[model samples]
Each structure stands twice: as C-alpha cells, then as structure tokens.
Target: MSTDRTDCLFCRIVAGDVPATVVATTDRAVAFRDIDPRAPLHVLVVPREHHPDVVALAAADPALLADVVALGRQVAEAEAGGQFRLVFNTGPEAGQSVEHVHGHVLGGTRLGWSPG
Candidate 1:
C-alpha cells in the first residue's frame, strides 16, 4: 500500500531482489512455485503492487485481484489439467505467512476436504 513494503519478502521477489521459481508473469501479477508445497501443483499468484491481504487488494484494486485469479487459473490449466483450487489466506490465523496478498493454486491430484 505504501508504494512497496521494502521488507516484504514477496515485494523483494517482485523486485528481483529475492530468488523465486517464477512460473508465469503478467504486467500486473507474477506466478511462482511454492517452496513448501501442500499439493503437487502448488503455485502462488501475486500482484505486482503490494497489499496486506486479499481484502485490501480487492478494496484497493479489484481488477488486479481479477488478474491474480486469472493468472492462477492459467497456472492450474497448464500444471493441473485445468482443475484446481485457489486459496487466499487473509490473516495469520487463516494461514497467511507473507504480508503480500497471494492466491495459492492447488491441484495435480484430488484434494482432500480438510478445512480444519
């Protein structure tokens, strides 16, 4: 929100200061493989601009949120045969580790239903 959070890890990744296994990228977003994958096809789609969480992103830029989702779909299609789950963890209790808003693309196998 403040232009770019210099200390945010994803911002560093976007700025090319941090190394990441980027899979797909657009002018508004970037898609990269998750280091600790919960699924076979685990990738993260994040906007180029920094936002604290998905709600902030959506409120500030709905179109960018759509772009992030669109990119997630593209990643799922290419890596998971067009079937996937897109997850947005909004807070620490919700499993959001990074401050930057991102959508996790999970697939490549039948996912179990375990929300807890």
Candidate 2:
C-alpha cells in the first residue's frame, strides 16, 4: 500500500476506515460500487495510493496506470458482461469531486456523450 491522505475519502476506504461496497480489491487498487451510479453497472476503480488525478498517476508509472485500467476492465466484464465504458475525470471542471484518481466503469445501458 502507498501513503494515504488523512482527509481523502478514497484513502479512508482503502484503509478500511470507511465502509464501501467494494466489488474487487488488488494489491495496487480497489473497485467499489459508486454511491451515485449513473448506469446499472457503475463502479469506481481507485489506486491504493493517492494521486491528484489520472495524469499524476500516469506520470509516476505507466504500469500502475495499466493495472488500474485492467482492474476497471475486470469490473466492467463482471458487472456489465463485457460491454462498458471507462471514464476518468481529471479535475473539478471535469466533474471529479474527489481528489483521489479513479476510473469509472459504466455500462448495462447506453451511456450518452454528455453526462448531463
């Protein structure tokens, strides 16, 4: 596990300090049920280590980024039966409410181009 931020909600979840409907967990990351799901099979895959966003994570190690994405694919296949979308919100303007980087797996229905 990586160093955690005391105030990060995803960090808390990673530490088991907070409860979440975790769908899958790996040495490097975790996938949990989204509190506010947009699709029938919506989940959030976050790294155990905190990164401000995906770009930051990518800068550190492409492999770790790949791991997180691979986890997202697994979540999608299990939850959506192989058809899904992977979305990453890079900043507040992009709709990322949490500071921790995460990959969203949404499917089981058609996802629109605009989240609106």
Candidate 3:
C-alpha cells in the first residue's frame, strides 16, 4: 500500500484513494472493475508497484511480466463463460487513460475484432 503515483489512476485505486469494485488481489498485484467498462466483464489488473506501462514491464522483470499474463488467463478461465480478451493499451493512440501499467480482462460476450 504505497501511494507512489499521486496522479496515476490505478495507484489511487489500489491505495484506496479511489473507489473501485475490486475482484481479486495478491501480494504483488490487484484486480478491480473498470468504471467505464468497455466489455460486459471488464477487470483491470495492476501491479502494486508503479509501472509506467507494459514496455516498462518488459524491461523491469520478465517473471513479473509473465505473472501478469498468467493472472489474466486465470481470471478469464474463472469467468462465467470461461473466455475473455486481454488488452494492454500502450499510449494515447491506444486509448491508455492512465499511465500505470495494467491489463484489461474483458469477457461475458462475443468481442469484435476492431478496437473500441
């Protein structure tokens, strides 16, 4: 429970500075519901430590990066339909609102191929 990012949205959510419907949490990570859900079941999984973005994860720790992906898959499999789409929007063009690194687990319906 560190308030590393005073401006990062995910940091705020994890620190209880911002309210969110948390789904799951671990020693190093936390998963919560996205306010403006792009899909029926939209869960945002973020590391407890502040990571600028996915690129940061690639350079910081390979094992941590893998754990994030593995967790996403686990959440997807546990969904009602046992299927989900994982998304990591990079920059502004990619629709990344918060700079903090996070993965979006979208499920509960058929997802289209195009971006939203």
TM-score of each: 0.96, 0.94, 0.89
Model 3 stretches astray by more than 4 angstroms:
1-3
Model 3, range 1-116, lDDT digits (tens) per residue?
A: 24488888888888999899988777777888888987888998888888878998779876777877777777777773668888998998898888888999999999889856
User: What's the true lDDT of residue 38 in model 3?
Assistant: 77
lDDT of 2 by residue, 1-116 (tens): 35568899999999999999999989999999999988999899999988889999999877889999999999888878889999999889899999899999999997789864
Model 1, 1-116: lDDT tens per residue? Answer: 66467799999999898999999999999999999999999999999999999999999999999999999999999999999999999999999999899999999999999886
In candidate 3, the residue pairs with backbone N, CA or C atoms under 3 Å apart (3 or more residues apart, or in different chains) clash, namely: none
Error of 3 at 85 (Å): 0.8
Q: Which one wins on lDDT?
A: 1
Off by more than 4 A, model 1: none
Global Cα lDDT for candidate 2 = 0.90
Model 2: residue 31 alpha-carbon error in angstroms: 0.1
Candidate 3 backbone overlaps, count: 0
1 or 2: which has the higher lDDT?
A: 1
The per-prediction CA RMSD against the true structure, in angstroms, equals 0.9, 1.4, 2.1
Ranking under TM-score, best-scoring first? Answer: 1, 2, 3
Give all candidates' CA lDDT scores. 0.94, 0.90, 0.82
